[model samples]
Target: MALTFHTGEVGVSRAEVTSIVADALRREAFTEALVATYVWGKGKRGTPRGSGPATLQKILAAEGLDVALAAAVTVLHEHGSQEAYAALHQQIPELGPSFFTKFLYFTGKTLPPANGPEPLILDRVLSLRLRSLAVTVGRETGHDPDGSVAAWVWADWNWSPHRYGIYLSFMHAAARQLAGTDSWPSDAAPDLLECALFNSAWEPSS
Candidate 1:
């Protein structure tokens, strides 16, 4: 089996990508807990409560924290993505790319309803795995995979409307490929694929 790329290109697919995610989802342990945290403001062991950045801060905040920061977080939780981004930009101007992207993920997860596009988490694990897949495809095809889609993600593109659109498009493509399959849970193709990629990247080496 070959994993399809954004440009309609194909690379040899690793079976473990699907298998690990499927196995994890079948157990419904870690994955379910994470989903619960995202859907509801409930913490699970190491995972904190709240899905959005500000909401997450509010959930994790201790007693007698900065009053202003707490107020800002409350405002961020109440608004949509654009407002949340603006709030984050003003509050945490020094935040890095990863934080911004994760903020987007959490915002998407919390704001959207069940039938909406499942938020794809673009953390270090997922990014590294995606780059590795791109490298594999490049080696096989003798063409640099640092094209638009790959560059937008792997090159650390900033969070913008255009970048977010590209990211959603890529996830939607992957979801379409994995749709209507029993490899994981139903109606969660994108997230299932993302979990598979993350697990394959982060799994301990023997």
Candidate 2:
């Protein structure tokens, strides 16, 4: 569905979703990308969550909204350090790690990060999943034997750039490991792993 970012009006037609994203990527249109990603991510919950002209106005009015997005574009296209890219974005209000990460994920569809895994959405679900793994690993290793470091690093929200760096590194590693298995395609993108984890398939269900 097409989205009017200035007004936050949801457009008709499910088929437009792909086309809108395609158009955004084709032209590197930040506004269109913002609309497409936000609409696509919110899906059915947009309207009830107070997605309207007023809310959208607030979003657009946020100081450094445009500047931050511009920096994101540079980071994505130039393959700048992902941790610094993440740190650059954390200051923007109205856009959090969850949503802004979606924007990053969409914008970077054309180029993989130079030094690490491409940006993937790191919402609450994925963070908690990481938290569980951290707790387990902490238990096994003396480094975080009490899981306190795990809790601090993998908190449900407001993750630091260092933590984001760790997350990207881990996701890429997990993606590589999954590719080695018969069930996963060798060329599958890391975001596919992000999707799987978000869809209730975190780790092997054992």
Candidate 3:
């Protein structure tokens, strides 16, 4: 099956998700709010709790809606909880619908079609899909044959510098391992190490 990028809705992209989260962190403190909201909801509130839209707007203004959305996605995807989902929805309503649906379609429905791309041969070191690192990808570099596009699609575009650094480090390590540089041949060791040392980080998982 041919790869079809979901372009129907102007809903959240992975880059948007990362951006919202990163901006929220830099603003006031959505992380703390998120934790508090989660705890409060879990206790006795039983949903539809906290400062509501006004307070959420404050958080969004401090951070930015896009940033907040990204943060919410991270919280839900990484943590994986009904409460997390609730926490996110308590802020951004669209996420539970369109954004998440796109995410599901990519991860659950489209992975096999994606993985059909040819493997990255040594001499033909094409772009590697970042989703394969986190979820799944066909085979072409970063998800498609184009490295730049893959990076744009898969790297956490919304993370803070520190968070981005940490993520990049992991990606670098993963690339090295996937490319068979972890145990390079004597004559080719240095080249592999050089490629491994490159920034090798960008994009958001799509």
Candidate 4:
């Protein structure tokens, strides 16, 4: 299906875009993959392109982008490593974890093995969910009983790499937990859970 923007503009169909991005990744066309991810995903929103495309242009033209993207691919699809994740954190100029992690998440979909936990989107919505859970757990455990710290850590944007790693692990674990159940499939991707949390409310179990 095509992801039509709120502006009533028709873009490429979802399957076509996914194939294009997957081919780009297989060809080591990181810049194209990144651009396709944004244009097809967030950029489709009615919001102005802003500095996003310009920033991407500058970063993609730089020499070190290949190294960063390559390492990200290796870690995300080949080895599934936190060390590489740390190294990739904010490596791209003007690109933050929120955006780059989306790239990684899409890459995980196109690529296989994941070698371990698959990468998934961790935008503000997902972080907010995590924050709510952290706060609830903290209250129950008497740690950060006021949830002040939890809210601070799970801010709307620019999360630290360590926190990003925590999100990946948490999401993958939750996906596994939901799988093989009555409603969730045994082979469901973690992104499914991420999307669910993004669209719903989170509350601590009593």
For lDDT, the strongest prediction is 4
Please, what are the lDDT tens digits per residue for candidate 3 over residues 1-206? 22223323244443444444345445645443343332222222222223344443444344345565455444444543222233334355422221222222222121111221111111111122233443344343344544444455444323222332343355445544545433444344222332443224333335
| Candidate no. 3 TM-score | 0.19
* lDDT (0 to 1) per candidate: 0.43, 0.67, 0.34, 0.70
State which candidate, 3 or 4, has the greater TM-score: 4
Off by over 4 Å in 3: 1-63, 93-99, 104-206
Candidate 4 TM-score to native = 0.77
Those runs of model 2 whose alpha carbons end farther than 4 Å from true positions after fitting are 1-19, 25-28, 44-56, 81-84, 142-145
TM-scores of the candidates in the order shown = 0.45, 0.77, 0.19, 0.77
Candidate 1: C-alpha RMSD after superposition: 14.6
Clashing pairs in 1: none
The segments of candidate 4 whose C-alpha lies over 4 angstroms from its true place after superposition are 1-8, 11-16, 43-51, 61-63, 201-205
Model 1 Cα displacement at 97 (Å)? 3.9
Displacement of residue 43 (Cα, Å) in model 1 is 11
* Cα error of candidate 2 at position 61, Å: 2.0
